[model samples]
Target: MTAPDETQAIRLSKRLAADLGCSRREAELYIEGGWVQVDGRLAEEPGLRVRPDQQVQLQSGARAEEAPPVTLLLHKPPGYEAGLGGIEPGAHASRSRGAPEALTLLQPDSLHAEGGPPVRVLQRHFRQLQCHTPLPTEASGLVVYTQDRRMARRLAEDIETLEQECIVQVTGRIADGGLQRLCHGLEFNGRALPPIKVSWQSEQRLRFALKGIRPGQVPAMCAAVGLSVVALKRLRIGRVALAPLAEGQWRYLRPWERF
Candidate 1:
């Protein structure tokens, strides 16, 4: 797949501003304060080019003067694109006009109100928060957006390797041994797929746990096994799960939470 233009040789401060929704001055301040890093190394230069392969991140323990980065876990409902604009390659590129901004889902009341640590809502938290995980426009599930460059880089670089668990609701009957095929007999982009764990969540729902999944891969795998997908929902990504947060609502990723 072709890399997005934004990922190639862009100035670090510009990238930060674009990703975090802050001004260039703010981005410069963050970088100069040693709050920003490129590929795990501290970057003091705002003009540094953020190569496509290099990851950009902010220190988890930034000082009070630095705008605290925020990582949000959103229960993305169908119809909204994950990112501000379609920056990720291969995913859908356009969002319907009048579609709600997924960030709006992050309201004061939506904060995980049960038992976890309480997170403050700040105006800056809503600004420039970039989506790390891009869900298809039709799919509904947990979506992650963050201002911390480090978390963003980690999720983006590890996306293909990180295990994602999805629940797929299907129609039609599965051919005998189809379950086994789903677990082992799939390929994408003309390459044999890595071994995956697939099992029946229920009569019509199939639970898939796999790494290196690409866009539209699940439906293709289902069709290869004589099943038709009716609905699909991602339930987990790495150690994070979509629970407690209801659809169209969002909550903060606690300081202790990873991925």
Candidate 2:
């Protein structure tokens, strides 16, 4: 890479703006969108310094428009933090030793083969993402993270009304009428719980569909009924289902898909 001379160096966005007769912000958008090339190499930083003699060009069919924000649906595995929550991307320096974060899996290689309709993966898409409806670190299944503000708002606002589906594996015997009590007459944190749908999926597995669930509530509910939760996995939140997504992989949320 050629370092620009201190006396003759100029910011890339400034030069591009002058060359294209456009605003600096537009030039920055073009550069950040991966449209600008400096000396035959892609220049993604608008503040990069360049000399007048260096070759500078825009990619063919380039436009000075901002890229659309994106949302990601991840099949989070157990033992990984579901939300960013003060953790750094790809690193857990601030967290307890050996505690990994699921956000680190949002890399190009981890993108599911059928990760929804084809969409270009950009570095910016990984930044500023906000995780919603966090799952417990000990449990695993579908988790959502998004950069779109409108989608974030929808998830936040509809949290109480939207139903969440979880598949819980339990052990030990249940008290008589325990399943019925689980459907209603349950309390968490000294507060009365609303009636929810619960059914036996198998001899050891139970399917629970409820709204506004709190962390640790499932296990508490099971304990109250003389059942011990052995494993738990969330399968869906509202209309989005986690099927077809392998564990430790992720896909893009479809455009028409809504919570």
Candidate 3:
């Protein structure tokens, strides 16, 4: 079999752009969206070199509109890092022997609902995801990863003020005036803590609603009140809640939903 001349081959995006009468970017999106096929096999790389004789066709119902970047809400289980912090850049490397990264749970099989988000689950959606919202490894609950810059920016800039709701389980008796102190009188790192909402949800469970949560802050607060934290789980961030999402599963952020 004679090898096709390399000089005669063209970039798949260029060829598809010409065939579809669309812009180069549009063609690339189509290819990256897994809607383009070459010789009946799905071809996802727009820069792939193709011979003129090779067949390139768009899948049925394929549209040229820009694909919206995806944002995922994951129910992170305890002991997994919300984001792989500095272990390996952009790689889901385990932080330690027993700990794994929550990013590893973003696979198609871990998608929360069968009838998922308004958008289809494409391989491209998983690429370049950024997780600005970090949950404590020792705690569990809602963690966010986004491919959209707007969503990323919103979460980052608003994090300090955005309210976080957590359910903490404890074992021990509270000190005198501890409930009031937990709300507004506690001092952390030599700075007076702001007023917060802390109340008992049940006999052993306490709910905390506050802003500017720090790593270990909840445990520290519990200890300050003479209580020992048995477990901690975040239930909500800003306006988004972690309900209906099982631990180790993820779902797309709805279009109407905001941070």
Candidate 4:
């Protein structure tokens, strides 16, 4: 008995559930798995709004067979390659002599102590995950790897724009005005480098928060300011900070967490 033209749009998951005789959760799963079509186009967001008259159809033979994508946060220890290529400083003698694979660090014991919901690890989960940023093998901090293509694409596209904060331990005298030059006046690869925020954490430690950083750029930046980088460890990326994750350990990125 609803009045004509008075039916407001409802959530797509709700509409799909009512139309397809399934639970709202199932509808959401279907939508996220690319099995639901809205007006002949695939709809991925379960929270999308749908008009009463809009067409919503479940693709024939559509099933949520694929496992959900996963993201992992690892506290990379010095020695292991963040992606590929680099020697593992502390690898077991039994391990093959080559660049240590980061995946080996993702052991069950390495999971966060206050673990959230239990997640079963499948071989497929590790198959095609793409690492977002590559930390140098000599440095250690948080590293991200994900199986979500959308998330991967976003990170790849915005990498140069995202700010990364690092703590660098150094040795040597800092020249007068050296800190100012490090903050503003610098060049990399024959081009003017972007401005960075640099500060002293301690007598021998410097804090740097910068964007568009290149591989080996941190060392080069320190060298420019009359500091020799003894060690460097990333502490933050975007809004995500490296918490108390133990070195060489990893944990599943919570569903609610975002970089």
Candidate 5:
């Protein structure tokens, strides 16, 4: 039997990413973020495994980019949780093995069940994307995933580093240069965020493109501008636009889709 064909276990990492159909960087992120599991045990190192038959999986907190190789141009309503839980416009919260899932600021339904998978399904799949956003857990619009690290990093930087675009409805009379101030005079947590492009779509309707936003910076910027945001929605991320999706819907990214 030649020593059972010399079956050997392999360490996981970039190689594992190719084997598992995720990005190398994502695999590392998953491991570092404590999302790796082997043979029903938490495996911290990507290179630690015993056999091909051993179970490999991810944890809940690490599986945000579930639902396969997807790119959603979500219409992100005002109150849906930005994470795996929430209620407003997206998917419904999937009940845990029995624990009611986790507590979320928004209703626990919008984050999991729409065109996307149930939170439990996502949590069961890949927890691999790095550089997660720390929003209110009730934020909405454009999320991406892939088995390609190169594409993922490019998308991440293009969306977060370049000017991100959004449409907001404001209230109250405008102070002079309020939009101008928000476009260029914004700062958060002491670091200077990137400048933005702001203009009026109509009275009470504003269109903005800002870079280096800190999660909920738009709302904060509105508050600073003394403008009450009656409604806020993300329309684009870099070159990816929300034009094709209806509320609560998602789709796989095209092979030709570039940042």
Candidate 6:
């Protein structure tokens, strides 16, 4: 639960989303139904945020649901698209491509239904990458895509967003001051970005756990610390990682996959 004024700090709920003129349910309905976003990703948490800075534009003439809620884990290479490839930058064009063979295809996999007004698919889609905040272009490992909305939404979207793992390659040693700054000195706009857990995995390799993120955040973070992002690949979203999948591939999100 969050107060309207507090919208600037965290997730927003259903009633709150309607307050912003979005739709029902925070994750899928609000976002899949079309318009809503936090920091930039299609707004998933209804009560996720209502901050003036948080964009809440309803997709005009958004289509109604036609599939059952679902989730997927895609080994998104440098080139593939994330969700429906919207106005977001990188999706339009990129170098590497991903495989979507893992997911159950465009077929609907219903997760829930009832005598309620209408049933909705809580599809949660993702693209794996090096930067926690991928450039509108840079690319890498696993990307999630799907039609089973609910479970997917829960896994991907939430105030309690799951911890994501990243493997990064950088060019040069980080400055003592810059590394320190990387740990806690940057801010998006004037809003303080989330704190991160950063460490070295090798001479030119580093690992980071961003407590929070702004879309396209990681690349900027590296630049701020004077590090060039040479390559980035995501390992996991929550407990879900790109284990069995190969590059540019996808698979059905199993019932056991939710984090």
TM-score of 2: 0.82
- State the local distance difference test value for candidate 3: 0.83
TM-score for each prediction?
A: 0.69, 0.82, 0.80, 0.67, 0.50, 0.51
Q: What is the lDDT of residue 178 in candidate 4?
A: 90
Q: Is candidate 3 or candidate 5 better by lDDT?
A: 3
Candidate RMSDs in Å, in order, are 14.1, 4.7, 4.8, 14.2, 12.7, 18.7
TM-score for candidate 5: 0.50
Q: Each model's number of backbone clashes?
A: 4, 0, 0, 0, 20, 43
Over the full model, what C-alpha lDDT does candidate 6 score relative to the true structure? Answer: 0.52
What candidate 1 gets wrong by more than 4 Å, as runs, is: 1-64, 84-98, 115-118
lDDT string for model 5 (66-86, tens) is: 233433233444344443332
Clashing pairs in 1: 20-128, 21-128, 57-149, 57-150
Error of 5 at 173 (Å): 1.9
Please identify model 4 stretches exceeding 4 Å from their true place: 1-66, 84-97, 115-124
Residue 145 displacement (Å), model 4: 0.9
lDDT of 2 by residue, 20-128 (tens): 9999999999998888899899888899999889889999989888888889999988788876322211111233447688899888788888765346666777899
Q: What is the lDDT of residue 101 in candidate 6?
A: 31
lDDT, candidate 4, 139-203, per-residue tens: 78878888889988987777678888988999999888999988998887788887889999999
Error of 5 at 80 (Å): 3.4
Question: For model 6, where is the 10-residue window of minimal lDDT?
Answer: 110-119
Total clashes for model 2? 0
Question: Best candidate, TM-score-wise?
Answer: 2
